[model samples]
Target: MSAFPEFIPSKLSFHLDSRLVTAVAVAAALYYALYRLQKVKIHPNEPPIVASKIPFVGPLVGMVLDGGRHVKSIGLLNRDKPIFTLPVPGSRIYVVTDPALAAAVQRASKELSWTPLIPELTKRVMGLDADTVGVVAQNLDPEPDEPHGFLADLHDMVYAYLGPGESLNALSLAAARELGRQITAHAAQLEQQSETVDLLAWVQHFVTIGTAQYLYGPENPLARDPRLEQAFWDFDHGLGRLLLGFAPSLVARKPYRAREALVAGLEEYLSAGRHEVGAAPIVQRRIEIAHLHGFSVAATARSELSFLFAGIVNTATSTFWTVLQVCARPALLAAVRAELAAVVEETATGERRLSMEALKGACPTLHAVFLECLRVGSDSYTSRLVKNDMLLAGQWHLKAGSVVQIAGGVLHADPGIWGADADAFDPARFIRLGEGKVLPAAFRPFGGGKTLCPGRHFATHEILAFVAMIVLTFDLEAVHSDENISVPPKEDRVLPVHILEPRTDVFVKVRVRDARAVVVV
Candidate 1:
């Protein structure tokens, strides 16, 4: 009863206790009144503001609690206004639901920019050092012929090498060949053991090994240590927390330790100069640029972790879902296999090969299925910071320094844009897209504009090749009869920067197909 010292002898203590009591009372009142503070004022011509029910902390709290659904909640108000503002603690985010407004923001490139955010995110999420962050921010938004930041140079280097040309083709060829080898060995082992395999785990392992083989080479750091594979996923899943300023080393110890451990392995790998030993052209050049920008060997390795994370995680997750979708539908599975089989040819020497070039365009249904899975399963946002006050799309004033969120979940499911079956899986959807009947903006699983994913082509080819290989040669089914293969439920808090991984483990019985099939040559 006397814990608070109601009869305190010290005046200063009494004063502090009284102030603390008032502070606690005010905090309680604010918490209780937040629900009633739902009407946010909107000035004429200003973007309509959606008052979050939780007062100052609403938007971020919603994100933490509901994932992409919170962004969609902001979108609910978009029906009345093409653009609306989501008020955060000290700032506002302009949410654009109308595709036309989204394109305007995309084209208004300079006024709304990814420049300021990218450096900050890199520093926070990737856990880059102060020197490295300086290097990354140095050339941010460079003038023509002016010195660009390490990131700008690095991005240019990535695009230059990943584009349609010798470099990209070489990387693709190496990756496809190595991936085939890994699949063949793994599938053979699976058939021999006739075991229950976690569908997502098998896919993640093969894809990581295959992708890492090309990025880091045969003596790859990840493959050398089996634990690193799971570590990568652990680190990826915790990215949102890291980005939200919950970045103390102990706050997210699991991912932080895993990431640092991987970085240490990468440092050890690079120390031996194995990156030059048959590394992808992209890898070699990225290392050069990192060194030019003053990154130490350890820093360069740490930076490459981003590439490894992106290359493996997104493609692997999508591939797992694509495989699941095909398995669940009989007609789609048969059609895809038929399309793939037709593309494979037997050689005089008795070896068969499916032309990678042919796979890119020949299998229309496979393309549709892959794209549809992405569209339906994707839940993310593409954000750009507002650099100046401007009239957006000739209406709606967006204040300077505010942020704009281009939500994929809302766009992908918009009935007006995608027709009545927008929410359903239609593998033939891209067929129409190919026919030029629909606007390209309607399908944005990989995002669009100046920020369009540079790894799209690489990722697409890799995913298709991997999915095609498994489905064509292996027969898979869920172990429990009651269990079914379908799009795994998404988590409550999926990150925009993440590839969609199933919320739970998907276990299946896998075996070699009895039907005659083409072998990867």
Candidate 2:
């Protein structure tokens, strides 16, 4: 039998179908009309909206694809505007591009607060349970008469330890001492012979170990197991997706796995009583505070992961860039080396030591180089959720439930603040500005106000120490074909961060200096 049926219509069944075509066209037009209506409605009192061609969907998609670069592009396009609104599907982000407005946003701590997001981050990113999240959420925005809660206590504790005082000095010195020891050991290994290395990787490895050993003590998990260190970085790279909390195991598989490994290691560290034995006082206090707030040992460990990340990641990246900036430039390197030599002294036993205090206070040229590095290299966003409708700079109106992000990268690039050479890397920029002239308020590397980084003192000390050690003890030459060594382009497209990381590895030849030949003391 034939497969085809003879009764099938050849011509009668297929007509022009003008009616169906008309219906499709009408539906598409109507759908687009509603889509346009759904776009953000701006009031005269509100900051002017910078609308995307694709309405609400475009801004969100741009953020998902470009990370912080999208914000920077929008900023560059609207450099004259101090503030503008970016509307996404669910919310509006008021981007503050002007340094004055940025300062205002930070000053309005109660109206535009960072505390509101802490619970969400603790629950979703740190994997805390609902009860623990509730504990954190309580009194987040307490009334005038209401007593301050867990969050307040945590803040006070952190500030007490990390603020500019005796505790801060001890912590900073400990970190510096640990890093110095690592540098000395590494230099000894390179004696009389050059070793080629990926500069950023080399910096990250030692910084991670040095910072962790001091913060988490001898039983530091990252130092004990190298795999955990790799895992921590993997998790950091995928942090944007992880923050969304949308089935991370499926969407961000590698980062999710890495997070699990870190959490497990942290749990083991805490459970085995390693923290009590040799961990930093702040670390011990952190564990204690979490337990005080009804957190389980596992949840406490998970919470500690955020601390570990904050402790080392940006410091490592900043140190890498600072070292690169100084060493890549011959004159700057020579100047920094000479300045560092003032801090080096020899005891009666012939043991040489680099004075941490002198490095912090006496080395003006080195300090300038470090500050210039931060000014040009920092790409962080200082974000606050607008808790109440407020007037910023007594002009632009910010609505409640919206976010106000002070774009540090955009501000850093403002020629008005940083001079015409804002985009260029000038090691002497800070020195040129000098003490009599007030530095621009746009230089917000450590952020500002209540949300300012408490660890700033420690990070500054540790980075300077690392750089001083390297500059004094070794010679770093870029392993490049060209005679002039170039610094690597920044990895701007990664996670929105305080420090921009290098996009590519820079290979450099490291040669240890002869102790007898070098001018020390």
Candidate 3:
């Protein structure tokens, strides 16, 4: 303790230094007190008291922590109410849940605009610059001067390549059937060899092949090429990154390297076709549309990838859930099979195969089951930015430029809209004109209003046909009986990625059923 020397101060000197320290402390306290008083004066908590503890970055951090579950939970908290305010970075967003409010938002499309945050995030991920972003933004907006040329061109392009009069539907149907046969054949081969394969991976492979055939044509390399097979796998892996608003800068710096690989392949494909104009109608059409609308090559590629993501991912998930639900509920399975038997018998061609019309009318119960699956499992949410200050939900007054969103998770399960058994997975709930009546406009799996998905009819037909064919041709049973095989619980965070994925890994032991032995309804 005495290793160091110390000098002792006089009592008078200590007292003098202490007084100086007290004066400095008093001045610091006065400055802080005044600063707090000034802050309170500048920023006041307005009506619809949204708490903002940290400015500009608080809500963003919160949403990231739980992947937007907090936003959905806020909606659930105010389900019965029309509107509530949620604090987002630099602004307060109103969460609207009431049907009337939703309708009002839909109707006021001119006054309100779809939030650009998501689209902006997508652009960032896709490496789009300011000019490309502006073009896409203009294209998405409903403008009086724009004349709907882009949309019209897109429709005609789809019609030309995949429409009823062209070879599109025939080609699509052939592709679907061939892919189905290939999948079943593979399954049979696996069974013969005593292989316990992953059903989900197999389904993904089937979907990837089928979808690639439809999009790029049966002659396209991706349809059969093994190297391009890895592209689909990469694309599938990149889907989560695309959806979760993963920062573009991160994608640019990450290991996935999906964007670079896809772009390189697409460029090579396009360059080889420069002298072969009109060789591929769909590809040509896409390029033409992009050029017409002044979108950059990258933007066009992103748009195509957007379509790929939407079609493959959602369809795969829906089909996966549909198969799982049917296997778990044997009564529902039997009902669908009985319906398929009658329809297939009446419409069987000389080849004893199901026709398009037969598939269409296969079973009311099957349709109900598909609808219920959609209602129970759909993961899309709708959002719009207010253009003018207005009162919402009869209470909260939102300012211009404020963002409002409706959580589909909460809306789909609202007791007031869907009755007391809203959360129950009952196919009869949607069976119109039979055992159960169809619900009202509240069931919006494809969304509602002017911007409703144009591909709804096609998507529905595809899903229904796939489900009916599977049920009619195969006997499916869940491998895990105790796993609560209904659609995965909505609130479970462990299944967040499941929203965009089909539970393909959930094994449903399947065996081919003889068509003749099955009883007709």
lDDT against the true structure, per candidate, is 0.78, 0.81, 0.58
Q: Is candidate 1 or candidate 2 better by lDDT?
A: 2
Candidate 1 vs. true structure, TM-score: 0.90
- For all predicted structures, in order, the TM-scores are 0.90, 0.92, 0.77
Q: What tens digits encode model 1's per-residue C-alpha lDDT throughout 344-389?
A: 8877865457777788879989988888888877766778888888
Where in model 3 is the C-alpha error above 4 Å?
1-58, 115-119, 139-175, 184-195, 219-221, 224-256, 274-284, 295-299, 346-350, 391-396, 432-441, 480-499, 502-504, 514-521
lDDT of 3 by residue, 1-521 (tens): 45333324455567778998998899778766644432331123222433434433445665656554665666676665666665554566666666666777677776666634545755655555677766655545546666654444564556455534445455446545655565556545545333333555656666666765566555444543456656656655544455555563375234136655655555555546541332245655677787789876666666665555555666666676677677678787778777766766532432235555655565678777777777787645567877777655354566777787655566777888677898798878665334324333355566655445555555566766676666665666455545434444543222133234443345555666633221111
Best by TM-score: 2
TM-score of decoy 3: 0.77
Number of backbone-clashing residue pairs for each candidate, in the order shown: 2, 0, 1
Q: Top model by lDDT, which number?
A: 2
User: Which consecutive 10 residues in model 2 have the weakest lDDT in total?
Assistant: 512-521
In model 1, the runs with Cα more than 4 Å from the true position are 1-43, 481-486, 514-521
